[model samples]
Target: MTQPHLLYVAWGYPPCRGGGVYRALATANEFARSGWRVTVLTAGRDTFEQYTGTDPSLESQIDPSIDVVRVPFEWPAQDADIRTYSWLRAHLPQVWHRWRAALDTVTFPERGYGPWRAPLERAARRIQETDPVDLVLATANPYVTFAAADALFEEGVPYVLDYRDAWTLDVFSGVTLASHRSRVGRWEDRLIARAREIWFVNAPIRDWHADRYRVHADRMHVVANGWDPELLGGDEPGTETRGAAVSPMTVGDGDRSHPRFGYLGTMTRMVPLAALIDGWELAKRRGSLPPHATLSLAGYLGYFAVPDPEMLATIERGRAIGVSYDGPVPKQDVGDYYSRVDVLVLALGAGRYVTSGKVFEYLATGKPIVSVHDARSAATSVLDGHPLWTATESIDASAIAAALGRGWQLSQTADATQRDAARAYADRFRRDRQLAPRLRVLRDVATTPSESRG
Candidate 1:
């Protein structure tokens, strides 16, 4: 039997450092593991290095059998170089921005990524002509990837939509972002209408979509984010698994009195940095936390290559209160940072629908976690039964301070069984395990005749 070919359209693939890239890389690799010939279409390396930063180590993790095609993806909006701007853009930045925004959406409803549709469409057509794709799976945020998949679908090639997060619904605000009459609304409606299956990161998002599009409800599924074992599965040679032997003290440091706290993953604007700083301060001064307890952040400052200035400033100010930013950690070195911290900090934006991808990795570490997001967040379900989990009643500093104090306590007091259970609870969320059922369905499609399949 001939091997089935899979075409994956993703804007944030390997080297584009962030949470989304892991999902895209893992998805494509999983298909290859299941005996499919996978080819990924993504933006060129320049897109990442120039705009969205990169962790080149992730490229090595891609399946060697897969063919990855990189195309030119331009982001005029993200270009921070002053020399590249026009006279009007330099003189009247606001007016120029509006003009560019309008022009961007003319081709596709998405603003920053709409222009990428053309390059992706061209690349998709070229790939089809070369290999005759059997199936297409697209992950979005540039959502433009779906347009390329939709183009193939128009030609009777079936595709799946993997929304790492919602597009039409503002997960942060619990508000509708666009209407059916709007361009973005129509584009999503068309894409979802044609997609063979639609995937979301969590149930709240899936439920929201199901409420809106009852017709597509059954077709929608929640494909929860799980940690990749290839990266954080276990300890490497000479190293011990974090939480394998619980140590209340920071690595190599004997001071058990001042436990170290850490937060990993991209530090997007969605992160509650301000509140976290205030909470950390309050926790140290008034709460049960040790006055000298230090919280170190290990990650990029923002989603883009040019980190957010305001966020950077805030992290700088936090230094006075024992909060320090250690900078971005490469994918391979994430474990090292995880091992150093006694407790993990999970400060997220206020959103019931928002679920952080790093939560899975945090659970896998078997370390105690402290969540500072809203109590109603979908993540509550994920962390509900976690043996060493500490959550805040609200996003208030008092609540966060109390939770932080408790988390530090858990880090010191959690027994080996509780530590083991923390990792064991995450066993069900292993990347391969999460993808297994979905892969089984896709396997049936791969076996179907190319002429009649969708």
Candidate 2:
């Protein structure tokens, strides 16, 4: 049988270094692996470096069979070159940015990426014309990519909406981010109604969307993020399985002798970093933590490649305490950092639907996990079974301090049997395991006569 063509519309692809890029890469590669010719449509390389930073290591993991098309994207906010800016932009940055933002929403309700709808739609049409596309998988953040999928749908191509985050619902606050009658809501309703499959990263998000859009409830699929098989040495020469046994200490301050509490991934505004710092201070004052112990944060301070002054100041304040900010590590080196830590801190904002992609990686480590996020966060469910996981019911400084203290104690006392059990719990969540069946189902649905193209 001939292979079906899959056009994946992801704004953030490999080397983009955005939080959801890994999932996008894995999904595209998985389609290719499943005997589908996958083509990824994303922004140019310069956009990632100027805005979100680039990780070349991620590119090495992308399957050679898949073709990636880099579409031009102009993000005025991240363009730092003053010489390239127009006279008005250079003279009045605020006014220029406001105008640019307004211009972005002309094609769609989304900000920063609404204008991309035109180019993305054109790209999709061009690609489909080149080789007829059977299925379209469009991921969101810049939900405007849905426009391209919608375009294809209008012309009779089936599409799936891969939502790494919510659209009309605010994951952080568990509130309606957009009104049901708002422009965004209308767009979402239209998009959902036409989508063959709509995937969310977690149950809460999937449930929220399903409940709101009752017409499309049966189409919703909860595809949770899993640890990258590449990072876990899935195909490496020495390693045989996703959760192969490793030396107790891997790299990066492993020999520090003191208990190390670590947090990995991008340090965004959504992270309760300041509260974590304050809690660490409280732990120190209360003598709950050892003198030599350190709270190490291994990631970028802001969402973008550029440094954020406010975030830097927060890091500096934490430095005064026992907190140390180690800059971002490459995707391949994640395990090394994970293995080095005695205990991992899953510090996140108070959101019932919020679950960071880092949480799965943290679980795979089998190290003691100290949860500093809200008790209601979706991550709590993911970590519920881990033996050495310590969670605080509240985000208060005192509660966080107590949790850290307990995490340190767990790190010191957790037996090898307990650690092995934690690793076993995480083994089921390997990227391939999570994606293979989904891809198979997608393939079946795409080929089914009843689910024919719109």
In model 2, the clashing pairs are none
Task: Indicate which candidate wins on TM-score.
Answer: 1
RMSD from true fold, candidate 1: 3.2
Q: What TM-score would candidate 2 get against the native?
A: 0.94
Worst 10 residues of 1 by lDDT: 243-252
List TM-score per model, in order.
0.94, 0.94
Residues 1-454 of candidate 2 have per-residue lDDT tens digits of: 6688899999999888988888898888778877899999999998888788899898998889989998999887667777799988989988998998888789899778888888899999999898888889999888988899999887788899998779888888788989878999889888998998899988999999888988889999988898765675444312454345332334234443577889988878878888888889998889788877888888877888876778778878978677887888989888777777888999887888998898988887778889999888999898888898989868778998899999888877777798888877887776767777678888876676544444
The C-alpha RMSD of each candidate to the native structure, in angstroms, is 3.2, 2.5
lDDT of 1 at 336: 76
Clashes of 1: 0
Worst-scoring 10-residue span by lDDT in model 2: 245-254
TM-score of decoy 1: 0.94
